[model samples]
Target chain A: MRRTAPITILALTCTLLISMACAVALGPASISPGSLVTLPNAWMIIWDVRLPRVIAAALVGCALAVAGTAMQGLFRNSMADPYIIGTSSGGALGATLSIVLFAGTGRPVFAFAGAAIATFAVYIIARQGGKIPVETLLLSGVALSMLLSAFLSFLMYTAGRSLHQIMFWLMGGFWNVSWDDVIVAILIPVGCLIIYLYARDINIISLGEEDAIHLGVNVERLKQILLFVSAFLTGIAVSIAGAIGFIGLITPHVMRLIVGPDHRVLFPAAALAGGILLLWSDTLTRTFANDMPVGIITACFGAPFFIYLLRSRMKA
Target chain B: MKPVEVIGIDVSYGAKKVLEAISLHVERGEILGIIGPNGAGKTTLVKAMSRIVSPENGTVYLNDQNLDSFSFREMAQQVAVVPQGISISFDYTVRDIVMMGRHPYIERLSSGTSRDLEICDRAMQLANVTHLAGSSVNAISGGERQRALIARALAQEPKILLLDEATSNLDISHRIEILNIIRSLTGKITVISVFHDLNLAAYYCDRLIMLKDRRVYAVGPPEDILTTETIRAVFGIDTFIRHHPFTMRPYVLPVYESPAALGSARRVHVVCGGGTGSDLLYALHREGFQVSAGVLNIFDTDYATAAALKIPCVTEAPFAAISPGARKDLGRCIDATSAVVVTAMPIGQGNIENLRILEDFQDKPVILLGDGGNPSFQDCTGGEADAIVRGLLDRGAVTAERIEEVLRVLHGAA
Candidate 1:
């Protein structure tokens, strides 16, 4: 392990804690520390409005980043993320269906079911003679994502009144988050813990499947577990925050550069850093941009960083 | 029981058959080598043993237990395979990769213990990668990376080690270094390796299994298996097999002459003795010349070469003077050939008649093969051999340096 890994993780943890505190205090009606002590309205705003929203954003961000890190290692491709294989589109479609048909009741359950089904479908489609080759898995993911997005577009066209709500949810924000959402986000850490147990296996498997087999990894089983868990994490994060873009894509990548590729260090480092990143992005939108969707800011930065990665990979 | 035994195993990838009814066994503590040309299923056989590929027809028994019965972890604890090479996607330190070998032992809930660390260190030392333990696998050389892989396999502390041409990608010195390391592990770890280099296989392996068309063509000690005929039949190449001077192992020297390049089919007689004529005989024989050699003793190296090439040679008893009978055979050879080539061999009383008889063929196109600067004949017959050589030179015998020059002169005569 790099000597700086623990230090980086500690620093990210501190940064995440500080960022959450600042986010909770600095939204639209900025409440100073003194006002927090004296004003009942400030206390109500902090407890009922900003606190749950900020905490859910951080938790959802952690879930996405951890899932992204797992996906990248599982596929042995640095470009892989939870959404690259249709999880987000599946969740989005499910969420859209809920919005159009039942006015967003049971949206999280629908989104998770959609995400899990889509991931397994991709896995099954990509399997050839009992092995899931990464290239085929990736292609199957893209194909399924396009089909799910077409379904999502059709649902949006039919929903006349809930169209505005669907568009806002698709853009993705934390304005509607509450304590109940935070309770659901608690499952994120449990999922992260499960993935962390396989960090060493992931390290071995990233070398290649054949090498992994030689090293005693039950490669097919490990692939299934990682895919299912990552999809679970991404599904929960999408259900909670409406598919926040690039927290999953960009955070794991940037943290990998800092902490190196040992998933033991990378998973936690990316989790904290991702939480910090989305926490700050949500804070920026709600405090300064008049509650605009945080996904816009994330995508504005994420797409370019992704493009840079592609160009640099080409050069390499 | 044998350490590894495959019984009537037929392996295939999808619908394409790779190994057909192949069976072999490795005794405990033997470094068994699998050798074959490309597409011979050597690697696939290794895969079958490691349980990477299951055989379609029969069973593999490891320590008399069914290979299918072993869990993946149990199998890894028993066997470790060092691949030809691996391209790691991450920049894992050499230590991290080595430590991963301890994965099968380390429980999923616990990190590697201090005992595991000690094993990893020892493995690195054995593989001579201790100094590179902290270097990124990608930053190191190919040879170092392969050593790290060896270290990783060693860290598994396996009872059986499998190498799939693991050293094939390295240079000669690295290959020797790695093989020596592996050789040092023989009595403790049973090894089954795939070899592309026949010389390395002959030198290092305790026994070799030669494969052809996805079947075991031959299996025996190197001395028995690496014969010119077996190699020619299996690899379709002409090889000169001889004992290595230092190791006494059978050394294979490939006769790389392309038969199509010089297929003169003209008759040539080589008059040589000692070991000097072996290369010339091989060259002439490979080029499709109807070559005959000697008045050589039965024990002469040239006689052996001639025998190996299936050339018609006139041979006498070892250490005996050229008799009247052998001289008659030599005369017949000289008369049947269009050109006669005499190599730079030591002349002695026993073989002096080989030179004196050449004097009778004065009209024949004679090429004296010599190393340009030196006297071709080691004239231990004193002035007698020198006088005969001078007489042959006077009668228009052309001295050509090197075998190619001799072949050019003979071709010109043709």
Candidate 2:
């Protein structure tokens, strides 16, 4: 188990850093290393524009992945992802509304708030007595996300030029990347990850509620804390990066195969894999075009992989 | 060894009260058998004791300490539970599953230690399924899986064991084996098991607790509490209770008798012979035909069956010849048979009076296994009996061979 851990982490770090460097270096301007000494814009572009964007992608990726991993174990589900439960849509609607309605308000802040609200709403609706039932959470997430999406589209349609202006944000871009946004993204995700790191208490919980209580876990309280931490990360990540699909949905799944369903390892492994995969996806995005949204790239790949995972694991 | 006690526990499923103010204690090193009719709240009681569902009205104490004061790991160390079924949807290997019971002892941050392995290994050894150490728990037979589950619970090294109808899903052979295993644990730990099978309860449990309508019906040593009246009240089935010849302990048999009016002059008696003829005597009694059995040896279950029927039995020794007094009484019974049916038990020296009925009764229907049945059965037949069988059959009495056909003939003839 120890050997498996370091090997996968090494593979993950190598993948993330290599992809991040490539994504930052390879863009529409395609500035050369030699020209870095010559051209004035190259240094600012590399350091300010591409680096923060790259960092933002990595942080958001890691956050979503860790949050998704914790939620899956807590729910005892293999396919639980942020988008399916309307977390992203909720965040997207929040981001779109804040941008269109609020006027010059920071997009990431509003998006994070939206994501958190939607998640807690889903959590509350799904709760029965002291338990957050898997089926209820799953169904309510679907319902609330759709409801929020409709409201978002209504606001977007009603607005004139602002609707088109916020389109790229809806499309999910890391383009107008700033150092401030990068720091905010990293901080929110890191804090959430630290809390989830403590949720190994959830493993005893996944055995079932009664078993958990018998084992002396304050099962309900632990669940509330975990959901809050996970949703906080997911909301903050979505606000910063838009609804980048595959990292949160698939990273946790890939790690569960490497490690058993113990959350202590699963949550960290998921965060790492997420951060790496987002770096790779961002690289693929940046390598293709400067202005393309990472969400499109993730959806195109994540959907098929989700199907594949579901099929393969159905037999298992 | 102080018993684990559940005190004044009340359990509710939503608003419906399933178990009311109920309390029972399981003494250490005793296999306390719990028997009741369906919906007797036995499983609910176990759940409450285990703190799976905390009792709404009362507290459970382990020794004298309040059970709620213990941590989950602490509670696990004191009690192990083999729930009704092994719900293994995941294909966890038997070792992984068994090792889960070591969760209380296992280090949270690292793999299990060798000491843990020894405890888990000893549990598997006790359950006698070490060969299934690497097998998938789901693929094993019901009996094997049950034992594997027992091993997992035992791996907790708990002082108290709670089982909720653990053997109900098993076959007869498995049931016997499981009960035997539980019986073997009598001196080591407290075992509270819910059993629907009363006979198994009688064989295994030193003491039995009977439940009815969410309340305790009776609790005592098995022989003292398990009786005809209790079975009738709890299960609403008419039964007969009689002592085992070997153990000198009573067990029950369900008897279904159809109520039919009979004329005062038409009283009847059956002088049944042979051990296998037990059912025939029962069928006769249930039909409102008076039944007497034996000169039967007490070693036979049929003697118990007969005694249960409240028949005026001319019982013999446990493994001995019939007494002269029994023989004479048996003759009086024989004279009263409106129709005599000789069940096809291989007759021998002690029951020669079973054949004596043939000569004295001149005119009546005679039923035998005919020629194709066990010829060993013919060994005890004398000259008068054979001639009379031939004479009676020829005299318009039916020569029915099989017991079913004889019953049919009797039914039509009556």
Candidate 3:
């Protein structure tokens, strides 16, 4: 197990790097691999347009994947994804509200604030004697998701002609992602690293709270730290990417099947896998259907694969 | 000095009080067993000692320090708890589970040290789970899973260990295996185990604290705490208490349920002695018959069984000839009962009077489990008791080969 861990990590890092380079080469106004060494236009296009978009996609993917893994570990439920905790739904609601009320100028900022507030609400609702019991957290997350989604539906109902814009944003993409977006999305890897530092404690918590407490884990504190960091990561990712789904939910599961459930190894692997998956999905969305949102491509491809994996795992 | 002392602690789950003002001290390096019927607060007490559930009223002291003063890490280093009935759905291997015990000591970035691995290896070896180190915890049997969890607790190397019904899921052999491991740790680690099985608790625990209705009913060595009267009062069931022949510990056998509905059944007087009538007495009592036995010597096994079953029995002094007063008392009992059963008890000189009482009941229906054996072999009075049995058979008393047939004849007639 020890020998396999380092090797698995190295392999994932390599996969992420290779996939990024390949993704940069595949978009519209395609430049040949050999000409890219000399051509100034290709360099200009890669640096000014493609590089920032790819960076944002990678950040969003890594953030969602790491957040999903942490949430799954926090709740000790296999089905606990980033969206299960109301972060994405809250982000979508904030983005739609901003688009309707403020004309979409500060949509990312409002979305980030909404994600943070939603997580804080869930955390406060679930807290009892400083401990956030998993069942209570899960229920609160579900309830908050339901409440926020109802509000979002009301906004969509009022959005008549502009409903197309709201719906397209909801489908999620990185069409106009900029250097400013990349700067804000940098917190994804930073938040993931913080959560990774507590991977051992998270592993113990996954055994159950009482078990973690007896094993000397400050279970309440660990829950607070991991949930806050993951929520922050999800907030930044959702603010920029406009609620990309499945990357966070599916990446951790794929990594877990390959590397086992030890969060120490699974966290980083999920981040790398998430980055590679989103980078390629973004490249395909841009190359094949220029107007299509990356979120549609992800759900179009990721959901069927997730069901296949689930059915196969059940058979095993 | 005692290492753990819980002083007047009360605990509640929401509005329902689970434990109230419970005070107990666990001596250092002793296996203290907690026993009680369901809802008796046994698990609550263990949780209190481990500091899992904070007390509403009082304090728990670990060594000389207040338990509340210790940080989570310090408390974990001193105390470890094996919780009951935890289901691990994740596919963590046995070694992965046990290695979690080192979480308190390991640094944030460090995976684990050689010392941690050594401790895990020793704990698994002590728990007899070294061979299962690679197996997923959920894939193992209940007994093996229990040992793996115990191994995890042992890896923590706590000075005090608390188990909450840790062996309830195990069968007898596995239960013994786990208890034997715990027994060997008696002098090194203080153990407070909640046991569902009274017999196992009596056999393994150095001292027992029996709980009744959220309070300590009795606290002492098993011999004193496991008395039949205590069992009846606390558990509300009639039980037979006897010293285990090897360990000399109190062993309890439940005899019958409450006789609320059984009191209305027909009374059957039994004539037997020397342990032969014990099964018949228990079966009849459990089958809802109001049973009475006769003239058994005070020290006879049959007498103990009858007393345990709470059957009304006429008795005689041990090794003494049945006196005329006792015979008259036996006669009164025989006259009152509707039927009588004579079990295959050997009649010695001292108890031959029981056979003579059978002659008085000749007019009443009597079922004999003679099994065609000569009564002279059992007769100590040189064919005197044999002649009484033969005469009874000739007088059209029913002859049955087994106790079941006797019950059939009597219950059928009823």
Best by lDDT: 1
The worst-scoring run of ten residues by lDDT in candidate 3 chain A lies at A129-138
Lowest lDDT sum, 10 consecutive residues, model 2 chain B, at B263-272
Compute each candidate's TM-score over C-alphas.
0.94, 0.85, 0.91
Q: Write the per-residue lDDT of candidate 3 for residues A1-316, one digit (tens) a residue.
A: 4348779999989988888787787787879977778887888888878889988888799999999898888877665666766888777888788889988877767877788788778878977864566568768888998898789778889988778767765778988788988988876777888999999998898888888889999877887788778777887887787778778778888788888888988998899989989988898889888747999988886678656755765785
Name the better of 2 and 3 by DockQ.
Answer: 3
DockQ of each: 0.82, 0.37, 0.72
Off by over 4 Å in 3: A33-40, A96-109, A120-143, A153-168, A305-316, B260-268, B283-292, B310-340, B348-353, B356-365, B372-385, B404-414
Could you tell me the TM-score of candidate 2? 0.85
lDDT of 3 by residue, B1-414 (tens): 569998898899989999988989988999999998999999878878877789999899999789989988988888988887687747889999999988888888898899999999999999999999999888889899899999999999999999999989878999899989988987899999999999999999989999999888899999999987898889888777888999888889876455556444799999988898888888788778888998898989999989877799999888888999999999999899899888777877787877787876668988787656333336667888778888887997787776788778987788
Backbone clashes, each candidate: 0, 3, 0
Against the native chain B, each candidate's TM-score is 0.92, 0.79, 0.88
Tell me the tens digit of each residue's lDDT in model 1 across B240-322. Answer: 89899999999998877645665887999999988899999988887788999998999898999898788899999988999
Select the stronger candidate by TM-score from 2 and 3: 3
lDDT of 1: 0.88
Chain A vs. true chain A, TM-score per model, equals 0.94, 0.89, 0.86
TM-score for chain A, prediction 2: 0.89
Q: How much lDDT does each candidate structure score?
A: 0.88, 0.73, 0.84
Residue pairs clashing in model 2 are A215-B72, A216-B72, B29-B189
